[model samples]
Target: PFTPVEHDTTQEVYTLLHSMSHALVSTASDQCGLATESISEMIMPAIPAIVLYAKSAEHFALGGMATLFETRIHPWVDHTIDYTEQCLLDPPCSRDETGAACHACLHLNTVSCESMNEYLDRRRLVGGYDSTPFWDI
Candidate 1:
């Protein structure tokens, strides 16, 4: 039940999901009182989903994420959608030969991203250059 073409497609989907996860984490940091580096991501491309979790050793748990999910989830998601609509590093970032991703946009710190900040594209989240946005789909 495997094919090379399907594998490529899966990787692309994973990148999209991963980028979206980082976007949410960054937005959560801004709105939820959690540090960007304190959040981590788990991407399940098969399920086409990502999970953002708090990973901090300095405390037993950070209540910010809990509070966000419990009360501010809707606004949190709205903010993430709005945030990804544009990047401070856009234009150059969007047309970069390295593919539309950069630290200023969809990247997370090494401690937060298990992928070493690779395989990300902001276009995957916002749509550009003919790629339909994940949110749109």
Candidate 2:
């Protein structure tokens, strides 16, 4: 059983990783042909990594991820980094009370998210207030 303070810290880290996972999946969808809803995230908090994969056979049949990784991986990564720098609803989204996570920027559908859309913050990736961004700008 985690103490309340430890639990809070754990949740914060989870949200940061989970938000990043959503961001990656969203950007990958644009580079690849897969729909954002068709991809799922598996967050490994201990390792601090997220694995994105197709949620359904239909999405896998399209071979979008395979093709993207085989040839366009670099571009995909670049796009994700660039894409996270700004949001369609910037300023307000970045300053939102939720620590910069929102539907327009980082939220995913229930089928693709294991956390029920909770514990997410774009600031973890893009930087905010007193915290530094996880990615190099």
Candidate 3:
């Protein structure tokens, strides 16, 4: 029961990101309970384009089997990771408020950024990580 919208590559990409985030958050919250194999599958598709293309983190800094992407790499990277993490942290709601930061809505509002990115861009930058040593799948 998804609403119809203008079809374009960017929209499709955002759609994919949104769906991917939803599935991971749902899977984690539901029967799975946060396993590596499952999270890997969930995170793989959107990592490069969303993270790399967006100039975010190069590799997902995995902690044990938790499999969280590095939200501390760069501002853009941190923003994206924060956005995705909020989707994971919170669930179906993914509230406009209540997040460590909220850039997930950037896909929908990349132009004005009345949510997420504007808030993140204003955040103090985090440190320690490089674009070198990219993690390929």
Candidate 4:
């Protein structure tokens, strides 16, 4: 009874974090010239903090990713927010209860995510008909 409801609530939160993480990876890849696979994410849904990092083939990947986050996190977040707000699979993805997120938008490589892309919705990162985004930015 309560278990399923609680799990759904937790999953909903994870979905938001997961979608945002994917957006961060997408932005990092586009801006940094690194593959999306090279970027990783640590999502603390409870704390509502998502840590995006570079996981290159070589050791530490020359610190470019760190410098990007350290210096440009604000812009990165702005970009991530704008990017997450829209998707190629919109309308349906955004309007549906599950949300407008699929492999194209929110799903990421398993290596980079702690959660196996199970509960994810880009609309949760932005705002949908049923929910509001956690971020004002």
Give me the candidate number with maximum lDDT: 1
Cα error, candidate 4, residue 11 (Å): 3.0
Candidate 3: C-alpha RMSD after superposition = 16.3
Model 4's TM-score against the true structure: 0.79
lDDT of 4 by residue, 94-115 (tens): 7756557677677777887666
Candidate 2 lDDT over 31-126, as tens digits, reads 887888888888877687788888776746358878887888888878877878888888998988867877787888888888777778888887
Error of 3 at 25 (Å): 1.1
For residues 45-106, what per-residue lDDT tens digits would candidate 1 score against the true structure? 99978888889744434677777889898898889999888878878999876678788888
Candidate 1 pairs with clashing backbones: none
For model 4 the local lDDT of residue 128 reads 64
The local lDDT score (0 to 100) that residue 106 gets in candidate 3 is 23
Write the candidate numbers in order of decreasing lDDT: 1, 2, 4, 3
The global Cα lDDT (0 to 1) of model 1 is 0.81
lDDT of each residue in 12-97, candidate 3, tens digit only? 34444443343233333222223322232212323423221211133432331223334323443333444343333334334333
Clashing pairs for predicted structure model 4, backbone only? 93-99, 93-100
Count of backbone collisions within predicted model 1:
0
Candidate 2 stretches with Cα past 4 Å from truth are: 1-6, 58-62
- Backbone clashes, each candidate: 0, 0, 1, 2
Quantify all predictions' global Cα lDDT against the true fold.
0.81, 0.79, 0.30, 0.72
Best by TM-score: 1
Cα RMSD (angstroms) for every candidate in the order listed? 3.8, 3.4, 16.3, 3.8
